[model samples]
Target: MGVRFSKFPLCWWPSSIKSNLHDMSDIDDGNKNEKDHLPGFTEYSLDQLRSTTSGFSPDNIVSEHGEKAPNVVYKGVLEDDRWIAVKRFNKSAWPDSRQFLEEARAVGQLRNERLANLIGCCCEGEERLLVAEFMPNETLSKHLFHWETQPMKWAMRLRVALYLAQALDFCSSKGRALYHDLNAYRILFDQDGNPRLSCFGLMKNSRDGASYSTNLAFTPPEYLRTGRITPESVIYSFGTLLLDLLSGKHIPPSHALDLIRSKNFLPLIDSCLEGHFSNDDGTELVRLASRCLQYEPRERPNAKSLVTALTPLQKETWVPSYVLMGIPDGSASSNQSLSLTPFGEACFRRDFTAIHEILEKLGYKDDEDVANELSFQMWTNQIQETLTSKKHGDSAFRAKDFSTAIDRYTQFIDAGTMVSPTVYARRCFCYLMNQMPQEALGDAMQAQSVSPTWPTAFYLQAAALFSLGMDNDAQESLKDGTTLETRENRN
Candidate 1:
């Protein structure tokens, strides 16, 4: 017979909170002011929400666990045809209506592109609900673990890491750093297929103690010891997320660390991503994850540092939402369309000579657009500028002028058109030499993003993490670097 596990509480509030219930009226007023300032937030009537959810029909239930769960979530369509996800707190979850409203309002005030934007809330005498923008692509868990079609691409996974870190950074900046349940399920994919952190995690529950819906192994050590989560604890959770992205399985942190120590990451990586990522990219991500999973919360890198570390791993920060979602372009006869544009086809094929011949024959010799079309002129110009800047930066780097190298590389990066991995790697090295591990990590990540297969990026990242005293992560990076070198030698 299977052992049935009891449902965990949603959140923990102090026992004294009930005694201070009268003061909650003042809190409600403050929440009102917050709600007023929150541009898109709304106080919806109970009837409106009920109607939208088709009277909370079972068919509307969308929560991963289903309607019987403690806090049920439903996908609903509003009268205006706006799709939304509504969370209906169990009656016992928040008995204090005022407290619930105040908490909801506080969370509603938070706004960021990475967050599933809260749209409205409802608080009747015995009913409480929070509504957020409906995510079309489902939760990250479904795509990562139980994908029905194709698995998530390596590029998309890397992008998710950067986006998630930025989201955490934004939340940390907004003073909402303590996420109640931070996990893959908390990440939902919006209409554009971009991952978004669910805002429901921001709301504080009325339960008297810390809650854990997941396994204790995944919970931060501090939460197990003190039964409370801090900002750094959230960072710790973020580290677990990195592990999730890398492993594609729910391995315990301790076990993961053991695997890292053993240099046994090959088995940890998902089979679906076998050839999708380079050894260096995997190693760098693992190392960053190890830092986040550090036993001491204070020792973990902050959200900003995490953002810097992950930013460079992104392949294209501005990929169209549809492409990220893997939605097929509906345009008919794409091959015929391509055939009509010989210049474009030639450019796509990287046949510069053919492109130039076509442009010259088309009588557009002087036009900048034609010039660019002829020989990828814009990219060529940007490369020339990048090379010039990189040369100066390389000179400074060789001369032991770390600061100047950083400055020159900063200019190169600011130009925003070049995608040179060498520049990023050199700048990362300079940042490390100058004792700027965070910036070094960022540069290393950028290098990897620009050239995912390059081993040097991993080596630089490992060096920076080592300087920051993140030994496990550094070791992981070294392992990845070695793997990449081995692979390169074999080729």
Candidate 2:
């Protein structure tokens, strides 16, 4: 077997962290001096264990993680009488000290409810222990899926996605931290189903892509083949998580990336849901998940965009009075008719257009009735612009005018609109037509994040990933698409 050693590169560390890590790196390689590297232990050792790990034991085993790793975790009371979960490091050859120190340093700077907070570590001789706050419910992988577990409700599933993404953003925005690892088993679900990103031993600062195989579903085909830890790789993993949350499928040894990459992702929702969720929200979640899985790392959005994109899928928050002057156009009136009240009759019967013309001459675009309707203007000006460009882009795509189409669609997306999905869909279609498979998948996934119940959005993503040789994931996408198709037909 090939042996490997890992360290967060000094260059990648921010100045604040570099100062703290300098002294820790100086900790002599005592085990190496005393003897050769142990067969089962990693570079981590007992001497390097954190001081906070005063008391830890096997009796505290809270719950087993997934099949991905064999770290036996224990939830125990420290000597100080605080509750903590301790995970035993599995490597027998290298010392546990290095991993523990890395986690400690990471924990020292990172703090968010979405991420499990490290309580301490216990490294005595060969034994390595990670003491963390004990979460009541186990990891999300166990509950939402697993052999006999009940499926989560749609609301809970969306909450998990939002909370989990927030956690990733929390990590990504750190001065020098990113969740290089975000597998399902590492995602813990609280009683309310809010997620806490746990397990950091494998969480490395080095972007060299963990030099090992993980659940294939979480690894993009590129990473699977190249063994590179990249930002896009993390997005791929998160996208797999979205699939699992939506379909309740685990990342099998072979994988699940392709499974949910279909046009009919609606059927991927839990059957128990009995069709209870808002279509718009569901579509958004599925799309967001797919976007995170773009094969090319650069094409995927960073965590900030993800959070901003998924915010609409969350529960209602109060909008300030000033925030919304009025509802968007279509929102105010139904398809029935615009009955004129006495005041309205006076307004409409008059020379409104002529008055608007005068106002325009006076340099008041706002005076126009249509301009006052935010949704109408958005749909007409912005959405229509996107649609128009997208139509032109489609023709250009068939004619092999890829560069021109990409430019056209890019402009449409850059020009703001009310809905994220509208631009996402237009841009996604544009990318696909332009022969940019990665960009197609990225933008399509973004569209889904804005509207998950829509199978078309999901299917578009499946087509993109499939074209790029992510065979396993493509297969899954087809399956999800089929499921949604059947459901739509039944409807």
Candidate 3:
């Protein structure tokens, strides 16, 4: 049987706990009325959540560990058909509904590309659930161990370390530094096939009891002694993760340190990664891992330091995370569908200099007539409406209201009036902020088509391309933008 906690009657609980439970009705009503101002977070009604998970059916449970546990996770599809993972906390896990909401809200507010963004939460009486963006790809554990397919590549492993460290850094920055459990299972892959740390790990331990699935040997020393976790303890766990990546198996930190001391890391390394990494690369990683595994919490380096150390060790910064994960490049087929005019063709190849030469040959060098012709083709009323919408969009964009910006920009674009490349570029940036990379790339392309010489267009294109896992193309586009910017400045 799964671990079980002793049941307690409501009368036996503390006054504060009882008060918290009594206030749940008010809290639920307030949350329902308030808009989810927090980006990447939502507050789902219990009915909405139930519909998503088909009443939390047994088949919906995706936790490899099992569903009978206090904290059970179910994979669900939202009403809009967006995939999500709903984590349901049993009554034994969180008796205080308010505490659960507070903790869930705190974690939900943390927004980072490296994190599996929290969609929302549900707190109604005894039911407490956390809804997070679903990851189609399984956890890092499945990929690292018990592999049915090819083993993870060395470069991908290195990238995962950097991503996880960056994720931790973001959480630390937001004052949610204490991760409940940091392990391979905590890393998940998104639709784009990029690895993201599960935000559920950010939830603090319950007042009722401490919880840890791994053996005590794998846990931090402080947690074993004091039953409390600190930020530094996270670093120690990160070290264990690094060891898992290197060895392809769970090895005790003490034993891993011993192997590192003997300079016998080759045996510890995953044989699948043989010949993929150099001796120096392996040595540097082992050294970093050793620092993280320090018995004393204060001895371990911070996440920022880990990022700095790992940055140089990354041999291919231009390779996108999806590519590193062996995901098939979707951008290639998308690129094929784009019907490129001559100028668009040049932009596609990232040939800014060639584009400039062609434009000059065509006698279109910043010509007033060309600008006027492009800028003045619409009726005054339509122009005024477009401008009004654009003004609102720009205001929203500047304020970081990406959803509002997207809606307003869509209105402006659909108005069918000619606008400046800057408008398209701005909308593209908003798309990027909203995690709509494909739409961002589309807008970037439109910007380039409208104004081929615009440096910002190429720059936005590069960013969009990089996000879509077309890194080589992104680099070329970035170079083109730099060249265009430098030339314009020189003139």
Candidates sorted on TM-score, descending:
3, 1, 2
Q: What TM-score does structure 3 among the candidates reach?
A: 0.65
Global Cα lDDT for candidate 3: 0.73
lDDT of 2 at 236: 68
- TM-score for each predicted model, relative to the true structure: 0.60, 0.48, 0.65
In the range 1-491, model 1's lDDT, one tens digit per residue, is 01111111223111111112122222332232121122367999989988999999999999989966888999898876678899998776788888888888888877666888787899888788999988777788988888777777878888788888888888787788888878999999875566889998887746742556888999999999998888888888888888888877778999988988898887668788888778888999989988888898889999898788777787754454447557542221222332323433342343435533442353312222211122387566676886688788767866668799889978877776555666666666676667777676666666555455555556666666656654334444554555565566688
**True-structure RMSD, every candidate:** 19.9, 23.3, 17.7
| Alpha-carbon shift of residue 81 in model 1 (angstroms) | 1.7
In angstroms, give how far residue 202 of model 1 lies from its true place.
0.8
Best by TM-score: 3
Q: Which segments of model 2 are wrong by more than 4 Å?
A: 1-59, 63-69, 91-103, 147-150, 190-193, 199-202, 205-214, 251-262, 316-491
Residue 218 lDDT (model 3): 91
Ranking by lDDT: 3, 1, 2
User: Which candidate would rank higher by TM-score, 1 or 2?
Assistant: 1
Q: Model 3 Cα displacement at 480 (Å)?
A: 19
Which number leads on lDDT?
Answer: 3
